[model samples]
Target: MTIQKIIRLLGRFFRPISLKWRLVWRLVVLQVILLTLMIFILLGGLTIAGVIPDNYEGRAIDVIRNTITKDGSGNLMLKQGPLLAELRKEVPNLWFIAKDEHGHELSEGTVPPEFKHITEALDYIGDARFVAEPGGSRTTATVQWAEDTAAGKVQIFTGAQGEFHIMALVSVTPELFLEIILPVGGVMAVATLLVIPLVVRSAFRGLRQAAVLAERIDIDERGVRLPVERIPSEIAPLVRAVNGALDRLDKGYERHKRFLIDAAHELRTPVAILNTRITSLPPTPERARLLQDTARLSTLTDQLLDIQRLGRQAQQFTRFDLVAVARGVVVDLAPMAFAAGYEMSFEPARGELFANGDRTAVERAITNLVQNAIEHGGNAGRITIAVNSPATIEVSDEGDGVPAAEREKIFEPFYRLRPRGHGAGLGLNLVHEIMQIHGGRIELAGSDRKGACFRLVFAQA
Candidate 1:
């Protein structure tokens, strides 16, 4: 299929679709929100990791200063490695680098080559006897130790005139990255992964129920409502709105049905009176007049009944021969055509002119259509009725065609195409009702010829 065709097909599926689509959009929104939150959290963690190491190293450097002492010759001495060794106790995993006045290495520990630059940078700023520069992989931090023998660390030992330079690099181990951050991230990811689907599933559960309920509700079954109690609290208001709409539809259907029944009942009295008066009269001019009125009244009554019945039986239809049904109605109404001084023709539709519909109802609907044409259509015109295919039926009258603008309104109840002096205008309305019941629609064709053509197209199952 072409892209346009595919889009049209999908558009049909999405058109007026209810809660499920909204829920799907909501799920996407939630995923975006969760992802944003995760990004913020990871950035915060990295920042904290950077800050903690600097604080830890500063404290370690302070402890190292306090650990060394001065000799009688004013030369610095390690009274005991205890002060330096205490780092192994304080921060169990430690790396240290110390230098004397001549830029000589005094001690080496667990600090990696990556950390050396950081230590030198630190010393340049502190103007201390020793400087520490840090280096490592981009994600990991390391410190490099350098001595500022003239200042900070060396100046602090001026009391004894001893030159002492010590620097250290201390870092949380790779184990800390594994144990702390990895496990935390893993836990968060697993929790998020597990909860997100459930949250999304739970969020959409009400929409699913709404969809199922909507599917079960046909035009005939308007009163059915979805259960609101089991739905999530957040969706309850929406459910209530849907149920309210269904309630209104049910009420409207009932009102329309009652109105049709009442109208049909009221019309039946005048029709019955006309028939009785016709039978009572002697075989004279009065009797003929009564009979003609009775026939017209009877036809009007049948059309009204057909309209009512179409509405009531809308839900009940089965596969049937549409051509056979149309043909039968044409034969039945043929006599009326002859009496009206018009010619009636039926085009025998080829192949299986089968449609899913009520056979009796289709016949009655067609009969009303044909009879209307014969009555209102000019005396010399031809009335043609045909079931052209499994999906379509056409009825055309070669009289002055209905005006283009009025064609659609002609299907409305009691809307006459001609002036008020003509036949009762219920024929097209009744046809419209019947077509609606059969899940089909009727259209007024634009013909170049001077005639009106009505086409009924049934929807495919």
Candidate 2:
């Protein structure tokens, strides 16, 4: 092969997917290949054992039977002495034995050593083969019976001609190497090579997901979310964490943009009032009234800015003690509550009560709920604030209840249930936004002439 092609092949074989899975894939593939090779070797050994006969005494038995069988007159004789000698010359490694019907040895030559047992066994009965590696020559022997039918029931010591044959076994070593070991080893090597790549390729699929995510991501793109659903369960948590971080980043950017827009809008009222006062006649009552209006507008703008900042800070955390913050907010707003001719009451929690939230943001959220109660509450109306654990903040007012149709819509931004001249509609809407940002929620409870109750729920911390 060309040097370039060889280099490329080497690169493909050696390079791993990623640091973590690369080692894992290598280990898995190595185990599979090693197991396969071990099985192959075991099968090879069994096959060789089968091919090289464990016992070859049967061939020697056949030779004895063919030579010692009776003729027409039932006389047992060497079928041909010359032929027997030639056979002996041909199979140099064999051992032979001959015996008559009376159990007398007629002839014996080159008999395998273990066949001595066969000779002793023949004294009692029939023909048999025996495995005998005499003097460690590694051979087998066969012994067969011969009878003189013409001399029925022969007396003791009568000699009968008979023949015994032994055939030496051929060495099977060369064939075993070619037919078993070499071929099995080659097949095992090929199988191991093929399987390693497939295993490595399968494991690398997860790494490919991370790579694809990194490739597709763009800083400007808030619309795209990582596909945590498609990731493997083992990696799903990491994907979720990354998606969560991205979600926070997107929310932060949105908050920054909204802060700019809302600040401009809130500042416009005061700036416009100041502009009108400056353009009016000097030291007049109208100018004084305009300046006074400007101050109120400025205060409102400051509160709106504080609300925005507070909500932004709360957006990232899903944990805080809502009861504690609520208590603080109630005390802070006590003076305003008294001036509004509203009786405000709060039940202090006996134990730690928690909500998923930002403390400042949740405080502002409670402030809005109470303010809405005060503004809509009739003269001498009572407002109650209470905290119920595992998550609940209730604000109720003894004033006109919200209409059924307007209850849901009241939380929408800039959508006031009252007339167009009513105060900023963002009060409850901001509360809704705060709850959403903290991963909690706000809902309007049932109301009658007894008044409206709004409940804020914080999820388990």
lDDT (CA) for every model shown? 0.64, 0.63
- lDDT for each residue of candidate 1 in 1-461, tens digit (9 for 90 to 100): 89999999999987984455455556555655565456445544654544322343555555545654445655455546765566555555555555444343334345445444555554444333333333531223323332433322431211011111112121443554466646665565666566666776877677787789889888655668988866888878988998898899889987987887788789888889768867886799878876877776776776777666665454677888777887888888888788888888888668457777788877767776777677667877789987775578788888888876886688888777666434577888877877877778888788586777778888754
Output the number of the TM-score-best candidate: 1
- lDDT (C-alpha) at residue 21 in model 2: 56
Misplaced by over 4 Å in model 2 are 1-320, 349-351, 420-422
- What's every prediction's RMSD, in angstroms? 12.1, 14.9
What lDDT tens digits, residue by residue, belong to model 2 across residues 367-400? 8898788778775668889888768899888888
Q: What is the lDDT of residue 186 in candidate 2?
A: 70
Model 1: residues with Cα > 4 Å off, grouped in runs: 1-146, 149-198, 208-221, 227-230, 248-252, 278-300, 311-320, 350-354, 458-461
TM-score (all chains, Cα) for each model = 0.57, 0.42
